[model samples]
Target: MRNASIHPRTLGYLGRALSLEYSAVQQYMTQAALAEAWGLRDAADRFRHETVEEMQHAERLIKRMLGLGVAPNASQLRPAGLAYGLVELLLQDAALEAEIVALYDEATNFCRRIADTENAEFFNALLQDELQHAAEIETWLESLGVARRTTEDERAYF
Candidate 1:
């Protein structure tokens, strides 16, 4: 039986969030392996760390869904992004982080508009985490002398 506590729109948000988090996990894990293949140990290590971070996010989302009396379902998972160079990989990751942050921001606003304080707080916390991740990607890009990328149509809207 479906729980009546969560708004349907919020449920959609939660599902999409889970999908995006898994997408991040897949992307990062693949990048880590690629980095290792290319003998970029440092890059590989960083990607591995990112993979763990994203997995934790996915787990948290799953637990929240379970607590809400819903069977968690991530309807779609995007393919892992592949790149021949470390810079290219980081650029893709930066774009992905931006997309995730945007989704969480929208979700938070929607929950707030519906006066769902608990869900609003949930989305807001995730938003903050993603924002920090994005900022870190930006800083890494800056340190590498590669300016942040401007991508059109990069967002995989769920």
Candidate 2:
């Protein structure tokens, strides 16, 4: 049997990352339902698709944690403060994506510093996905003439 050991800190980070991923899935699902209720079928479809992607990400992370012999924990997720409206939903998603991007960036850096090449590569790919998600949402918001931008002083996470 091959023996692989993961740092305790890395395991803790993975646990936190898993929670974030779970939260994202829930948020996307809520957003999708809200869009459908508001009679925006296209928007709802997009949100649903995004939710599926988030779920997949969570599963991947879970598998990685297990492979590393780390116990996976699902903690309560942070709430996303969002008002009830289409514009609000889009803006919230964009902001959330940005936060996720920042998180993955940090994780990647940490992995590299610890010489965890595999995790660093994985996080780098996740960061790219997050950036794309943010860009897509921003484009949609801009098309709707909703100018949304996050300031540096704003909180890093939702």
Q: Pick the candidate with the highest TM-score.
A: 1
Candidate 2 weakest lDDT stretch, 10 residues: 149-158
lDDT of 2: 0.80
| Candidate 1 CA-lDDT value | 0.88
Report how far off residue 75 is in candidate 2 (Å): 0.8
Residue 116's lDDT within candidate 2 is 90
How would you encode candidate 1's per-residue C-alpha lDDT over 1-158 as one tens digit per residue?
A: 67797899999999999999999999999999999999999989998999999999999899989988898999899999777898898888887888898889899999999999999999999888888788788788888899865555433321
State each model's CA lDDT, in order: 0.88, 0.80
**What is candidate 2's lDDT per residue for 1-158, written digit by digit as tens?**
21255666666677877888888898999988888998999999999999999898899888887787666786969675556888888877776777778778888888899999998888888778877888788789988998776667333432
- Pairs with backbone N, CA or C atoms under 3 Å apart (clashes), candidate 2: none
Candidate 1's C-alpha runs over 4 A off are: 149-158
The segments of candidate 2 whose C-alpha lies over 4 angstroms from its true place after superposition are 1-4, 80-82, 153-158
